[model samples]
Target: MTIAKGDKIPAGKLRTLTADGPKDITTDEIFAGKTVVLFGLPGAFTPTCSAKHLPGFIEKFDALKAKGVDTIACVSVNDAFVMGAWGKSQDAGDKVLMLADGNADFAKSLGLDADFSAYGMGTRSKRFSLVAKDGVVTEVNVEAQGAFEVSTADHVLGQL
Candidate 1:
């Protein structure tokens, strides 16, 4: 089932690129004892994801942090290298955590995985954003297919 408000985030290993190399970050390591804003997209560097979805969060990072959000993360079903490159290209800097769910484990756990074979993208996560406090989701906004309304940073900030 799609994860909802009040549900505990499921366990999974996501990859993050570091200077040393790709590192595995567990779900508990991310959400434990903190308020996190996590947004997932279909893929990195896609038109909408690069043009709007990711930029919205990057632009609103400070506002979201001021609202007591500890971490802002962007997850996609791509390898760490691609995620890292995308982050750098977008000038994400230290503002947003770029997570690589390369195997779609996290997306599947949340029931957010969708097949994009028609687009030649294979399986990917739906566009969505959520607020998790101390490991439990407090709010979730899942966008409709091909829509960008609910999961925008402005909408997520309004929920804060």
Candidate 2:
């Protein structure tokens, strides 16, 4: 089922590129004790993702933090290296944690996986954002197919 408010985030492993190298992060490790705002996108370096989705989060990082958000993360089906490079290019730095769902396991678990085979991009995560507190979802903003309205950082901040 698609994740929703009151749902516990599915258990799975996600990857993040650290200074040393790629590191594993359990879903619990990310949301267990924090109010996390996580936004998942179709891919790294894609038009909408690069120009708006990711940048919006980076721009609103401080505002989200001011509202008691512990972490703002950007998750995508791309591998860690790509995620890292994109984060760097976008100046995400420590403001937005770039999590890689390389194999789409976590995305599938959330029932948020999409088929983009027509575009030659196999399975990818649908664009969405959710707020999780202590591993339980308090809010979810899933965009309609091919839409970017609801999942933007400004909209999410309004929800908060």
Candidate 3:
């Protein structure tokens, strides 16, 4: 089932590119003792994601932090390299954490995996966003296929 509000996020390893190289980041490390805004997309550099979803978060980074969010992270099924490159191209800088769920482990754990084989993209994540406080979810907004309403940064900011 899809992870719901008040659910404890499942354990999984995600990757993020750093100055030294790719590094493993655990779910606990991300959510424990923090108020985090984590948004997931189908893939990196895809049209909707690049044009709207990710940019919304970037543009609202300060507003999110102002609302007491400790971190704002963007997750995708792509590898760390692509995530890193996309972040650079988007000028994400330190405002957003680019997390790579390369194996879809995190997505599956949350029951948010979507098959895109018909589009030749294979397995990917559904568009979604959540607010987690100290490892337990407080709010969740999952988008329907081809929709972008609830997962936008403005929506999450309004919730906050």
Candidate 4:
């Protein structure tokens, strides 16, 4: 089932590129004892994600942190290398954690996986965002099919 408010984040391993190389990070490692804002997009470097979704979070980093969010993460169905490069290109720096769910395991586990075969993208993540404290969700913002309003940073900020 799709994860919702009050749901604990599922257990999973995601990849991130560190200064040394790709590292494995578990969901628990990320959300444990912290307030996390996790957002997912269809893919990296795609139109909406590149232009708005990701940038919106970067722009609102301080604001989100001010509201007690410990981490703002952008996860996609891409690999570690791509995620790293995309973050660098977007000047994400330390503002957002770029996570790669490579096979969509995390997305599928959340029931937020989307089929984009028509676009030749195969299985990917639907646009969504959620807030969790120590792993239990407090709010979930999932965008409607082909829509982008609900999951934007500004909207999520308002919810906070």
Candidate 5:
């Protein structure tokens, strides 16, 4: 079942890239008592994700933060190393939390997995974004393949 508005985030472990190395953080801890803006992409460094999707967030980080977003995260099925590298490549290293859902467990749990084995990328995350307050989702924007209609920072910022 797709996680919808009003749903509390499921508890799970996700890896975060830190200066000290990778750190395991619980989903609940991250979302608990905070307002977060999170977006998931199929993979790190993919064309759309690099060129536009993530840049949109990096560019508007301050505005989103001003609107009460405690954390702005970009997640993908890639591992911590890959996600870290991609963040550096995009010059977004300091701006966003680049989270790695290496196994797609989090995505699957949210019903956001997209199978792209045909394109040689196994299971991946559907392009989507959400706003959560104190662990409960308040707004969700999931996009169809190759579409960028709803997940833009501008759209979510407006929601806040």
Candidate 6:
């Protein structure tokens, strides 16, 4: 079942690019005891992702923080190296947490995976965002195909 409002994020292992190096972060560790704005994309550096989605979060990091958001994260099915590079390219500059779901484990657990094999992208994450507080989902927003409607930072900040 897809995780929803009031549902606790499931325990899953994933990698994050940290200052020290690649590090492991469990689902529990991500959403536990904090208000997190997490957005997922089909892939890093894809047109919409780089042009709009990720940039919105990068520009609004301070605003989100001012509104009491603890952590703002961007996640993709790509590996940590790709995610880290994308973050730097976008000038995310440590303003947001970038996570790699290289195995698609977390995406599958959330019932969200894009069938991009038609485009040779293989399995990927659907564009979406969620607000989780103390490990439970409080809000969820998913974009329509080829649309960047509800997953942007403005939409999520409104929910907060």
Q: What is candidate 3's lDDT per residue for 90-113, written digit by digit as tens?
A: 999999999999989999999999
How much lDDT does each candidate structure score?
A: 0.96, 0.95, 0.96, 0.96, 0.93, 0.90
TM-score of each: 0.99, 0.98, 0.99, 0.99, 0.97, 0.96
Model 1's lDDT to the true fold? 0.96
**Candidate 3 overall lDDT versus native:** 0.96
Question: Residue pairs in steric clash, candidate 4?
Answer: none
List candidate 3 stretches off by more than 4 Å: none
The reply for model 6, stretches above 4 Å from the true place, is none
Q: What is the C-alpha lDDT profile of model 4 across 61-125, one tens digit per residue?
A: 99999999999999999999999999999999999999999999999999999999999999999
* Model 2 agreement with the true structure over 1-160: per-residue lDDT tens digits: 8988899999989999998999999999999999999999999999999999999999998899999999999999999999999999999999999999999999999999999889999999999999999999998998998899999999999988
- lDDT measured at residue 99 in model 4 versus the true structure, 0 to 100: 100
- Could you tell me the TM-score of candidate 3? 0.99
lDDT of 5 at 131: 96
Of 5 and 6, the candidate ahead on TM-score is 5
Instruction: Judge candidate 1 at residue 36 and give its lDDT.
Output: 98
Candidate 5 segments whose C-alpha is farther than 4 A from its true place = none
Question: Candidate 6: minimum summed lDDT over ten consecutive residues — where?
Answer: 1-10
Clash counts for the predictions, in order:
0, 0, 0, 0, 0, 0
For model 6 the TM-score comes to 0.96
lDDT of 2 at 102: 94
lDDT of 6 by residue, 1-160 (tens): 6778988887898898877989998887888889999999999989999999999999999899998899998999999989999999999987888899998999989887878899899999999999998978999998888888899999998999
